[model samples]
Target: MEDLILKHVSLEHPANQQSHETEGLSSKHLVVRRGEPFRVTLFFQGRLFNPDRDSLVFRAQLGGLLVKFPATFSKPQSYSQWNAEIEPGKSVRSQSVTVTILAPAFSPIGLYELCLHILTQPRQYSYRIGEFVLLYNPWCPADSVYLQTEDLREEYVKSDVGFLYMGTSKNVIPRPWEFGQYEEGILEICLDLLKISPQHRRNWQKDYLCRSDPVYLSRVVCAMINCEDDRGILKGNWSGVFKNGVSPSEWSGSADILKLWAESKFSPVHYGQCWVFAAVMCTVMRVLGIPCRVVTNFNSAHDTNANLVIEEYYDGMGKKLHMSKDSIWNFHVWVECWMARRDLGSGFDGWQVLDPTPQERSGGIFCCGPSPVKGIRDRHLNLIYDVPFVYAEVNADVHTVIVQNGQVLSRSVDKERVGSVICTKSVGSALPQNVTSAYKNTKAVMPSNRSTDGSPRSRRSYANREEKHTLALSMSLDKTPIAGETISFTVTVTNKENSPKILKEHINAQAKEYNSSPLETFWEVHNLLRLAPYEVKTTVHHITHSEYDEMLLGDGLMNLAVVMQDTGSYERVLVTEEFNITNPLISISMTGNDYVVKNEKREARFLFRNPFHIPMSGVLTVMGAGLLHKKVHSNVSLQPGEIMEEKISFTPKAAGTKMLHANLVFKNRPMVIRGFTTVLVRAT
Candidate 1:
């Protein structure tokens, strides 16, 4: 038995196909899901090995903790403990051995080193095979992050492409986002995110040990997604100017951002908004084996202090005042991860909110949740995590206050404006599945669950319009406004009384941002009109393209209002409507009904039409994972009503569902148009 030496080891053989490591299956590292067995074969040299007398021990090490188990030549029935064993008959006087290593469902996740010890007569030997990575397995029933629903696991864990619902609730825009968890180098970056955390820096061993718990792992991921602490991944930027880095709107996927973060030595990426941050968090959570989905709350309120109210102060001329501390966004995005809450007892084990946006600090850190959705719905404000903050975002009351010269003129409270629509992308589809009912009861019952008296607040309204009128006043757009075209809207007024009346119509338009208050008035019209007794009249107003285009910056948006004052009675009515110019679309079509296979070339054509009479010029960038290794840029110019066509060629790198995205950034204007085509890559 002097020549009983191990010759070769096999990990990439066909035996590993059942590991369910789609992304990492083709990776160089030994990638696998927890609670499942992965096989590694060993070949011996010279003479047949005698397993009856010789002994072998397999050990796996993470940080400072080491686990060792002797080879039993039999499979362990329970996945509660890590075990390694050789096949019984293969070890019987044979020169080859097949070993199975089963990691428990509760093992700490990260990179681990595996070693083997061979004990024989008069000598002992040890071999360092290689390193492997362990990720969460939703398919594993014994795992803490298990999801029995196959569709949910497919949508959350396996699906690499998804959408983030943006725009207002009335006109929700489904923005495509590439989660890219299975993309090359992305899983490693997600793993490195945990390694660079403050918890890991303080005590590496304790951090690794706690990773066995999904709750702890998710909280760390939330805090690490924002740069407010730990110099994390994204530095959020809400302001329109993104001179130093890429604007949050320009990022179509997370892999590019993750790669940039890693290539920059783990420094914070230049900028990220709510959706961008949430998308990155989803990628990390899903790649780590936690089921997650991106959610959008239209008319989402931001209560500065725990008060359940968002106040809106408007001046006498219908100008929104910036006096209040609280503000409401047109929409707010966050991620909901599915995990069992063993800490919160039973009944609270469904979807939990985990916001990575740097809005407020929780536990002196910039992370939000693992706050159970049921807790928010049932008004369980006393639970762990930041439930009060999330509850206020969706359920806060809007108190519209007309403040002029430090005096209150008129006040109205709107209960349905905040969180009128809350939803996420549906499973296996691009349509939105409304989850608002899951968050709040449809009865419109107001809960006084939040504490009061912290500070004065404010809220903005866009979804529903409230009207209180002496002589009825209403304003609405003729159609959805588009860039480089005349915007037309009609104002309707009626003398409700039985007598004739004289009125003054004050039509004002001010530039506004999506998140903050409106700026100075860009356009206004004052007209005196006479109405017959109990008569209804409608007037159409138009803002020329050049007139509104001069004030357009960052985003093509404006808050328009018409204040009607009765010259006879001194009573006034205000009607306001906020609208944005929709960007043109870049339409893409493939060559034919052909299958996109990995490592094969495909051709696509992108077409764009310039609706504006004026000439348009911009740079078109085309990119996709598994298709294009890097972004391809081409300068494009189009005349008025010109339809331009461009062709692109790409070769996929791996087999999976992928998307090819094209973005056209207009020169000297803050306008952009996007288009994408889905590619189902088959194995070549």
Candidate 2:
């Protein structure tokens, strides 16, 4: 272990200091003499195991001030590789790092500190070794580069010398990018681009072509504002865009504009991910002199369910596919661009969909065909329903045309019927591409549960969308504690509409259902019962433990937060609660003078000689307050009827009354018990 500490960190003076306003902390001072270059250095003092053999690494941060400051670390800079190494028992005296700060011509510099951090490798024994920050001052600069790129090819290779993933080979190729082509049918709700000139529109139309084309970046941008495909339909992947736009002035802002643009087109959903949209937007923005970046997610909005769609044009069964695995599926992409204002802040940031489109409707008229019509009112032929096939191919002579009501002279003519149209029409042009199912009978296969690895009994991943009966629910906590001292909640569901059947499964609801079902989808659907319109039905549920919940309580404070968001629309509702274990006030009476500590590391001892009020069982949370350790066992079933003798050890860092908060949950009632006891440690 190294005894490292921050020796010197400060913001040098005379720049410009805002007076101290808040308590204790003073106002920023020493504004970098406007336009003058300043130097900031952080000194580190520590006892390292070995200075000669051990590697020293450091990173300097200016705390997010937009300046032309060039920062250098005493230790080499390598992003994905380890930077420092110390011998097991050697020692080092001290080290220092320097950074040059150049204030922008338009910037108003003030007092600001620099933070430094030391890194350590993880090991079996939990070790929190060192954390320290060093402050430093920054002055103005004559003319400094805002962002600097380092030639780190050698460092990158040396530190990252290993067999890389196969997919990394794609980096060797430099291909001309295509932009904006995916936005053919995207629509942005908040934007009004109706008056954009036609010439600009034509330019934007060809923007998504090869970047090597001779078109100027500005011309392409003019075209981007006008390229709109009205017929394209996609899933509501870009739903969050309407609410915000991008801010280009801030470094860490969000990509709201890009989100709008991306969501406007269904391309994000059409491709099963937004990669095309994000890529095109980023490329277009870069060409337009706007800095941009791309973000990718393994599981994106397109395939929220595991039932992911991979793009592939069918070319017989056994042969290799044309598209590569990387381009097919498994990857989703989005773009972040410099904007004037982020949706949430003024930081130059925003996101938009490269391919925007309207949300596709699920339930629509899937079949439609032309109907044969005879003389008006002669005999209404039921060709639409009875002979739906006849409409697929209509005969010219069989079809009739009549004159309009206001015609001076009545006339009738025979029009040529179009060729056989074996067409299957849905309500929207942008319906989701249906994939061939691996199993024919979903009901039969659903019952034969199996894991993704083909295990005998596996949990099922549900991807249903029905479950919207009453459009309302009531929640109540069960009096009976199901597990531990926790209560269960019962939600009563009801439906209002009578025409449509209530789907038992929960479906993902669209934020807006201009074309499909109105109800939103949920991950799990339970205790569903059919009820008449305006009737009410209830469901009882117990909160199950999730890995995240366990992680929350693992810390000192147990924080619980629930976010109910409209996934289709991206609307959110949040509920939060916190439980703090501060002071356990109850008193604990021990039978013996000196208690023996056991393997459990608790100080409590229970002898089989005494018969307690009753045997209790639920959950067990063994903890040592001063020792900073806690263990929670869920759904614990304790057998107290047999003779039991146990000694628990409690080691406290400080001599005080440590509290133990105990809770018992039962079917009929739940009880909470709190107790505390003093711990004495022998003097060494």
Candidate 3:
């Protein structure tokens, strides 16, 4: 009895003889883009085999079916040919034999397995050599949809870093997170994602990439990441009502979420918010060779009724009334994918919005746009997909009405607040790029053909008329406030009349749900003030975290408004401000080690203090892209004035600058304290 073994294998270009070896084949996955030419060389040896009398057959299988190759077995080149060793008594022996595999340009994108069968006498021996993955070529003429600018290529196509901008427009802050799409585990998850089709099987056509379009593929991704129909991938719970007690923002990367989803086939991934959904979708898109960038819209409007207006009503006592179906989120995150809209034709090819947040439905499914950005800017609401819905997200008028006993007391309109800065991560950097102008009109320009009237004044004229008749009311708040702290703001009212006047002042603050209506009222204050002619009065109000927690709605984002009315003239004015009550920034120190080598395990200790007076209990999650896999310690309780310490053991799998994130969420409280540190991982 003798054994047959594969010595080595290599892929080479026939003309240039440029080769890639398959020595540690399983460890290294071969990659090639569509329309590329390459030849595979297989070297094998057998103990009792005669090369002159035995024949070998090579076969390539894709999606469990044999794929046809154009050519195989070129004339043996000197460097790869088999040399026979003439033995004294051994029957004609060959040390090694080489075979060449020629793949055509039309070979589709997929994992192709190569197998070799040796035939001698009545027995045939078979072995699986290796597998190669074919990807879509962005540089190819037929794949021009993936072609992007250098900046876009760096930010969306190549880089796995993402930025989530929270807070208002005046104080926009960026939170950096990593996506591990290039990781082997994440790549496997993405490949599996393509196969789990709930409603449709359009992700891969005939198990071939060339047969499908990018537009449809992107839509499928948006639907899959949300786990809308199928078990899906990410479970979304914006209300923080998760069975695991961990908020969506606690998770660090898409890889961990996908890994959890893969491990627990019965249970979907724990949690994901808008940014998480968008970030994970970016990973999936980029892994599939589609250019994608996560976008954050400040003061994003969610018009549930398809109307280009977000309306809010209030009572005379300054209590916010939930009368309208529309609402505005302090910030919302979505992804913009670059692709050619062959389905929609010319003038619509570019970055298309694809939101996987699962807020509303589009075309009966939970997937959102392929809606063209140009159409949104030009007010082409008649276009396909959810153009009207997205148009209002970036350019919508906010109208606030004060009513008492079903009578409209006063109404004011704000045209500049609904959607503020539309931002994305800058190319090759972590900074934000203001792409507001790309989504809507930045300069003073004529209204699009879809406008109610041809003139821009129609939008601003109503607001100006209300301002002239009502007293000047302005509301200002301290720069971004943190939870577990007192937030103070002043409301100033000016009486411009010549005669003395009596005014009624109403101040209201209420918690609001993301993309939904306002929730329970947190705090409210009503007062009567008398002002002399041309007199200005300023009143300050303070709110504590305990008071905010009492009426905390979804995520602790609040809508504060001040309504003032002139009792003498019966004129009214309203001023509103939107702010996010973020968790107090606790000091987090990472010690024990500053760096680690790739594939080496290291332990790091982290100390984070609880700034709140009351004891807190929640989950502490530590995660990183290539540095540390997700390690979470649940039911971590911290006493007042106590510093909680956690030790994390992680193995660095990839080299370069890696980020380690620690998120602490207090159960039943709308506070989520987060801290991160960058570590250098050298290649092993």
Candidate 4:
């Protein structure tokens, strides 16, 4: 044994990485997928190796955890444990030796140090061979994170560009997002997220050990995404004021946010909302080799109590009141990770919910899930990790109460309002794929016999229920309203009975937050509406910019309601419409080149028009990954009906699909306009 001389060691990083499909994870280390075998070779000037006389032990370490396993002399067969084997004939060779090492499917996914021990002649010798990274394998059948098809894995794990569904369910809008998992500095920061979490700070070895399970990893990532409990990634901001940090709307991709967090030494990135949090989490998951997708729930319920009931308060004139802590957001975004839930019994394996929004606490932490979607859909309250909470988020009943002072005037229970639509980006496309049926049964078969269809006829039918009163009332927006312009809407009243009826119409308007209740009323009008026998009448009213500009200044949410009371019968009917005044759009166009080339300068022009009766001034910020190195900003002023065009020049950094995002934030007013264009950069 003393005569044996060691010369060189080989980790076979390229072939191992290619076999593990980890060529994109990193370039500095040997990256391999867990549950697969990677070869390590030894080249030395030594006597013929003897397995019986010389004992070998291999140690793989993560943080403070060091696992030692004995090496066998034959080819490996079973993969039940962490084991290594020398090639069948290489163990008896004279010069070079090859050994295959297999990390179990459930091995923790992260960087690991490999060491070899040779025991002989009453002494043990050790050598530090190399380090490697292990990641979840969607292609491996034995892995819990495995997906069956290549198309889904491509869509969920490989696609760097995605669209987040927003706006009302009736009019779903797709917002482009750059996952940028493969971009420079993104994968490094993503791995750093795990190391920076509170669990890692407390006991890194324990944290790393649990990373073997996608369930545990998802839970940790969920908590780390919000900075509430731990000094994690994004600091959430739902309030309209963004004075000290960047607005959530200003962010178009995860690379910028993750890069900022890493560059700032893991300080929480300034601002993030639900969609931002979800999008950033998607990027991190994809970078770590997990299949994940962003999902949106329209009319999503936020039930403070676990009673499955969301109580909403409104005034007689139909202005919503902030009396209850529970809320119904127009839309709430979260992520669904694909994995097999072995902890839960059968039927729980599949897409599991993992929301990063700091909405509620689970087991005394701000993390919301790894909640089994199957458990939520099946009403399995006994399941762990806040199943009941997510169940209520999509299955709660809306209890609408109209109160006057301290008295309740009108009360109705709407079961179909919450979770009316659940959707995600379609595979290989920008269109939305409805997933409402996956969470719960279609409501058309429920007692309400209502459909989740966002068609105008269905909405009208849902809005106007035949009442016993004499007058039938309905309300609608005149056109898609925008801020900095007049707001106009129409209210119709029809006589249902044979006799003529005179009615008093009370029209009111109030501003509100996205999920919270409305604040004080900004405007109201009263009119005497008279209808002849079988006559229908429509009236239009306008509220100039000055009338509700203050309300639009924050969240751009407003509610219009009309209460009609018959003069003879004293019967009353109320109809209301909630709307959002969208900010003006900044149209972005490319120039100078027919196609974007890597390492070449390109220009993008931003065009914005002033549609108000007053002058406007704002700051424009533009950013792109693999397109621009950093954010670019400029200032502009525009008169009424004036169009402003600004050009920004930047050189492409890497070749791939990229997105150019432009945002115009009004300096003197509360408005943000957003636009994005996709660029396919050709490699030079």
Candidate 5:
């Protein structure tokens, strides 16, 4: 391996501070802004170095000009190559060459053309070598942009996760997903419902799952097998199956048949949603005397952040979950299949969710029902604007959703600045090892119910253990609301454990003074369930927006204490959220080019001086009569006191001319200025 050794390097530019943000020319993706003066530095270092005694030159192609500079290798850190004498035992250790170019004065506002070329001698001879490189910087590239990651111990990798793991067995497991007797019965039932109320079948299926109704589950399976193949129970349309329209009853019956149909010139699985398709498979399997159930959950519910989603990969955390009460529940979904006892298979004896849902499923047993609770509120805030998550101080409300692979992964609120991230056990590393049987097959499928028999197989067991993590949670609220409105805050607690459990109450406080208020009144906390390990629980509190204002302004700044406690041990993680409500509206007046007077018969060049103290993005439009004569717009970014120019040409038809209005529109809002210009016209 060759170690990078620099012998000499230098910066050339109008200002030294400009050199700080230079992304080296060798970077593949170079970002740059037009009209920004920049500096360049040249560097070279190697064990073998030979200098041309005659001349060392530096060149660059900026726009059209070829700028050149004299280059020298006089300062040698590790070696002196001035003499032709060669070193036999030691190698020329280091060398460097650098040059800076001022961004051309007349560079256009768009992407400019430029390249760096280096001219130097070979190691042994004075033969000059030339190399080219690119340069550019994105606008407002910060010196330090943080990439977020979770806080986890290396041991988190070794920690075990508890899940129902069923052993895999060929005979007992049912070779095909479809053709199970139990599944067939369910599909038939669903088909019966479609016949009765096709319009509401899908909704009924969803609601049934929410209610965890075994009968509804069976009906779904039946519908999958019996309903017209082309009919989407969800959409209730007898649309074309694959390419040619077919009824659900005639839809492909077997999984293998469906696969073949998919490949066929017609009828395929593409015609329906995966869940619906899964239902079909489950139903068919039952008809053929196999057994199966659908299991679902959120992949990274309440566990990941924005950076992970933007980067499109898991950054040591789970999938990005939107911060919502049920965000954690939507992570997973799959099929749990059962056959016979010896067929139950060894390691795969437990109930396991095989197919994942498009979105995470709620953790509780509300499989197919109207979400009884409103659930947690997801909040979002634009970090660049430093805007509060909520629009109003007292009634700040925000809904944030985290999505991935076209699915909602999780949801949460911005109780504060969303501080540090706590890394939970890697989902991949959390697969449970110890297998426990929760249930054993007690009955066989009746001939009418062709579902695969799980009578031989036993269910898996789970241990209830508490795993604690320290999350430096940043909590914030929407903008403070007006006095009459109400303010609500929702808090979510995630259980990293495996078994079902409840989240206990701890300190949830909102006080004007940190010292005076007791750490409990902000919410009435309750545990909705023995939330399954890896489940999330969310609670919400609605207070009179006025009640919050007094507390917030009572001490000038509002301070809130948030805590998530484990009901068992009362172990809790505490965090504080602080915010101030202030509305400072400033008005300004401009001079110089603020007023424009144009002569109808003459062309005018106008210089518009920026008098505003802040940068802004706006458009300038020349309005006359009912028509828009000319329109000019600035980029989204602007700086204070930036000068710009505009030119307009016009011809007057009569002796008198009306005032021209120059309106500056920012963020869709307009500011107008009018000045009447007198025009004298002579008949030609």
Candidate 6:
């Protein structure tokens, strides 16, 4: 009998050999979907023997269990030929055998040890080839929810959502032009997700996606995006400790962030606020074949306790005090994944909330939801996965109290502010979709239980307008002012009183974050004006860049407040207005299609006309994450009324949504002209 020798081993997908090469398949481990055919080619040599005298048999085992398969003798072709050529001798006498096996549709999702055995007359030779991982196929008939054909298009497959980071300090509401584009890096994220241990993958496959229990998958994904666990990919940072000078809002897509995180070997991702976290989560879900959209809630409340009330304290001078555990963000973003909730049964299907932002902890981990939108809308606080917390975000009432030396001077209730204007990107479009009605009732339903003081129950409304008070106040800007230009606004205060009274007016303008407290006073005016009964006065305040530059916070959003006190009655009325200091505009136009494959070169042109009388000379800086290298061109000169054009070429390093920014600064003035464009990088 000839000694049995295993000469060459290879795997082949007979259907499409070239496509498998691009897929980066490995011989040690083969990935296939359930109900798919797995084929492999093996070459072996033996001494010459009569066909009838010697017989060879093959067998396979997974987890030490016998897996029956069919084998046949055939010539090596496709990928197998490449393996055969790499061997020492091309003329070696050997028999090429092909094995075809079918993974059953009901096969568990995991890595299975595949063993090939060659049986002869006296003994059997066994070779441990590799592992076979069977994954859940959403396209298969066994899947509960099937994605429609249209969903495979680039719009749904690759989408973008706007995030309004109005800043935490001021209310100057800038346009919601900042968008998080998702795509490109999805494949890498998906591959990382599949690297989970075999047992964990098997459990998720069986207990989650396979059973149509998307809530579990949603929860897992929320935890995996942030570095709260060892399994998470991106370490989140909200403190703005980025190595680059880029702000958290400069990130335009999830792909670049994930790519940077991966390139950094799983280090903390820089400057990710709430919107960044939610947008990236949307990309991961969509890439894994789960339908998802990013949702933004204006005036979103973070109720530390379960009570649906947010208590805010203010001093006698109208300065806000952080005395309560509850707080309301100017805007908070989260993702809504579309899946059938097999765990919750009927009405809970459709959109479910999944917030990846590391806010409050849930079940000892910093992840929230798969909280059903239906549960929140129906006020089912008892449901699982932080439904009550989410409900408070949209339905809670805000109580603003003015206190002095721990004494309550006055209290005001705002029922319409919290959880206003919940929106998402429309399907197949970039327009905003009003999803507020989906989270709450159309008609206001007062809570059956009232506070001990017999006040109206706290309820949320989708209306845009605020209710008017007895003392009407209005504000307007003189003109839309750009950065470095003077900003001026007029505040008109009216008193609706029957008799003449002495009024102490306090008019203050301060730089603030979009959703938080006031930072520094940009301009202030205080005076005691004696007015006739039902008198109205308008005051105009002007702020120069020299006066506000150092005090201006992120994005230069400012809050203007007018407070009037009736000295005799100690009654105070307050009104506020928010506006943004515009930045100098530089037109940025792309020369080619904004969407391109990874490593493909694209070009953009930046044009800016010199507004100054003198010749302006400075450096033009171009930057982007994963999209372009930081490039700076010095000695950029522009004459008065001359349009300076600079073209930049970039090759995207990763797939996904990306942003390109150009900043030009003049040596003469403290003026910066900036422009940016969003691009979609697809992975081929």
Instruction: Give the TM-scores of the predictions, in the order they appear.
Output: 0.92, 0.19, 0.80, 0.88, 0.19, 0.70
Candidate achieving higher TM-score, 1 or 5: 1
Best by TM-score: 1
- Per-residue lDDT of 1-684 in model 4, one digit per residue for the tens? 444555778898789987887665676778788888899987766565566576778999987788898888765567878899888765575567788899988889888899988776666678888998888989889999999999899899988888998766655667778888867667778888899888888888789889998998998899999999997899988777777888887677898889899888888998999999999999999888889999999889999878899987766665667788888887899999999999997999989999999998988889888988888888888998889888898999977666787986655567787888899998877678888888987742111112245312222212233234566677766666777778777777889889888888888888876666666888999888888998999898999998887667445777677777787886666666666777777898998767989888888898988987778898888878678777888988989999989988989876766778887778767777778887889998
Worst 10 residues of 4 by lDDT: 454-463
Reference-based lDDT, residue 92, model 4: 74
Per-residue lDDT of 669 in model 6: 50
Q: Give the TM-score of candidate 1.
A: 0.92
List, residue by residue over 1-684, the lDDT tens digit for candidate 5.
332334344333224333323222112222232223333343445433344332344344332334444444332222211111122222232243333233321221111233333333322222122322222112212101111121221111111111221111101101111222211123233223333433234354344222122223333333332224333222222222324432222222233333333344222333343334444444432322223443222112222232212111110112222233322211122343332112222332222222212222222211221110011011222211111211111112123333446664333333211111111112333322211112111121111111244222211111111122522222324334222246455555566666655554443434432112222244333343356667665555565644543344211233344444455754444434433232111122222333323332444343444444545565554423211133333333346566555655554332322223343434321122212222223334
Check candidate 1 and list the clashing pairs.
311-458
**lDDT assessment of candidate 1:** 0.82
Report the Cα lDDT for residue 355, model 4: 94
lDDT of each: 0.82, 0.26, 0.68, 0.81, 0.29, 0.60
Best lDDT goes to which candidate? Answer: 1
Please report the TM-score between candidate 6 and the true structure. Answer: 0.70
- By lDDT: ranked, best first: 1, 4, 3, 6, 5, 2
Question: Comparing 1 and 5 by lDDT, which wins?
Answer: 1
Cα deviation of 443 in candidate 4 (Å)? 7.2
Count of residue pairs whose backbone atoms collide, per candidate: 1, 81, 1, 0, 125, 11
In model 3, state the lDDT of residue 2: 59
Better candidate by TM-score, 1 or 3: 1
